[model samples]
Target: MSTKQRIAIVTGANKGVGLAAVRQLALKYPTSPLNTGGSLLIYLAARSPERGEEAVQTLLDDAQLREAGVLVQQGGSVTVKFRELDIGSAESVAALGEFLKKEHESGVDVVINNAGIALKGFDSAIVRETIRTNYHGTLDVCTTLLPLLKPSPQSRLVNVASISGMLDAYSPAIQANFHAAVNKGSIPAVTALMEKFQHSVDADRVEEAGFVKRAYGVSKAGVIAFSKVLAEQQRQDGVVVNACCPGYVATSMTEHMDRPGAITPDEGARTLVMLALQDLDGKRGEFWREEKVVEW
Candidate 1:
């Protein structure tokens, strides 16, 4: 409840990259007398409350932190509080916004839009579902929570994007729009692009239309675009919005994937943690890969 406590929310944090990122953020922001103006309180959000709390208990039980829900020691004062969140659900997101307003009077400090689902292969079985969660869901969460983030002195919004989301996924025409209006949050354009992609898929001409062949890649492209548009839209706000590609992280999502050079989830989270701690005024909107900003 102290003004010195920094609050954060990480979506889909039950396991894998999301879970790892939550742990790293907690460790990075812990309060210490030498560096303290604030202690970190991370809300590890998962689809199920039971799963969310279990993940929190895993963090506490693993002896990684010295306490739960409060600071117990320097460098270990961070606490991971579980909260149920399913970004894909409008009802769920509305409830979370209300809860944050009531629980944290000031606003949220950090928002790691890490909840994402990637469906490999070019099939209709999951194309709609992927877009529903990764694109529409992420946008919903951001739109609902932007108000809460307005109060932080240096708030940060890091969207978990992917290398596969490179602009080349789209045609020159589509890519030009994204690059031309670099500082505008074109939510309508993004929505239109999503619709176009779906249409291409429905017509079975996705590849012919200059969009990514797979649903996963296109969805991530939406995320990368969202970060840019959001950062551009909120140019006056005291916050940073950046997209990070954690490489091919070794998680369940990628277990069946035959990709090379995949790193552990914890290793993948380091850059995300670094981004979260950056001065909000320093980097307004950037797409990053392996700790360095890359062209999107």
Candidate 2:
């Protein structure tokens, strides 16, 4: 590990936007603002080892990468490696932390929490699982790996949120609570609100409780809130934490929807790649889409 080498980890990168983000990172790393004349080591993480490795191989065999000598390490090249990680599993998250600790003593430069679930339904069980994976699981990964952040301007944490997660989707009271929780910079407070939403689902009173009936949307809202809280808390640490919506991309996650104007996975990954590797000029704790900060 060279002292100048920068390390990044992308979760749920086996396919879709996650994989596209990984690809863009590798292709852009050498010229990225954060590059410092050293290799950019990227960990493409997924729950399945076989799929993760396959993704790694795909990157290694990309014609563009090969033409640019990125795979051959001609200059400030990129290295894509496979790491099995299931963010929904605490044990798996912990194992990834341990591996990072051992492999990169210099600390991690970037973390993109893209692993999430969007089940089709409006029941308590569906709500619980959606929140558990999208919000809680993402939160767990952030907390577990926060200690390893490099603590520099180059350090970044990008949480893959959605426009559906915007606070305006909820009632005024519920939106106010989210704002209050984020202003307080309390992860627990935000988490409690998520729990309240879940309970409301069980009681068949989501709208009555001021929450929307969309579980995926509510969970993403929590992610946006948590991102703000984390950004406030990590201001001094110099880590740029922001949430982003990838738009309606044509991926496995959105195949069930009738998205006529859906963008390509590579196109949807542009903002994510920008946030991960571009110079944000000290931007932190905001929501972005199409490479611009937007209201969430």
Candidate 3:
């Protein structure tokens, strides 16, 4: 890869918003002789390699895209390589880190931590897997990929959070307490609240705690917290780390349920794409909703 070519990795991109983001990136960074440098090198990493390959091939085979030179850029085209990455598995993440280090030697400019689960399949197992993949897994990937991000002059890190994770939406009383903790910079207090809610399942008090959706909300809240912490740590490195709530997007995740004011996959992907391309100049650690920054 050339110095001008920006490399980005979007996890769980086999379908939905993830796939849409890859398509937009390819289109925005097209190949032309007028543009001397390659625009972007994208890794559409998915949990299933076959699905990932198919997604990339589909983009490559698009008739309109081909005619418009959407996927190709400069001397090199937008190569969508498939890599199996199971965020729930630590072993998988470690192996992926090693693979990227060897193959993408120049390192990645952007890391969109987009692989997430809603915990809808199981009872107890669902809750456990949600926290593992959404919170802990994201942290593992960040640490493992830290070296890859260190070299970039314009590095970006985004955590796809949810409005349901907003403390105010939970309960007014709880929000009041959380606001106090936040004002005091008490991260431990925030973490304790999450732990309390997660443990509520054990006592069958999750509903009482305003965790009717339970694990999904808690997991996304963890993402928001993680983004804030990471942004503080990497602010000086020119790494803009932020989180966004892609408001009730209509996708497979919400196919069975009733959704109002639901945006299309492209709408969700656009928010993420903007974050990926945002100029660092101290716009770090912001929590956004659509194009606007929202209060945490």
lDDT by residue (187-245, candidate 3, tens digit) is 56656766666677667777787665568877787678767766777766767788898
Instruction: State model 1's lDDT.
Output: 0.78
Per-residue C-alpha lDDT of model 1 across residues 1-296, encoded as one tens digit per residue:
88777778989899988899887776666442212566678899989888888888787765554544333443455777888899989999999999999999988888888898876567665888899999899989988888888544367788898898888757898787656545455777777787888898889888787777778877888788878888876667766788899889878888735567878889888778777875433676788888888877
Off by over 4 Å in 3: 30-36, 73-76, 121-123, 151-153, 171-193, 207-213, 256-258
Candidate 1 to native Cα RMSD, angstroms: 2.8
- Quote each prediction's TM-score: 0.91, 0.97, 0.86
Q: Over 4 Å off in model 1, which ranges?
A: 31-36, 66-76, 180-184, 256-259
Question: If ranked by lDDT, best first, what sequence of candidates would result?
Answer: 2, 1, 3
Q: Looking at model 2, report the run of 10 residues with the lowest lDDT sum.
A: 68-77
| Clash totals, every prediction | 0, 0, 2
- The most accurate candidate by TM-score is 2
Clashing residue pairs in candidate 2, if any? none
The full ranking of all candidates by TM-score, starting with the best, is: 2, 1, 3
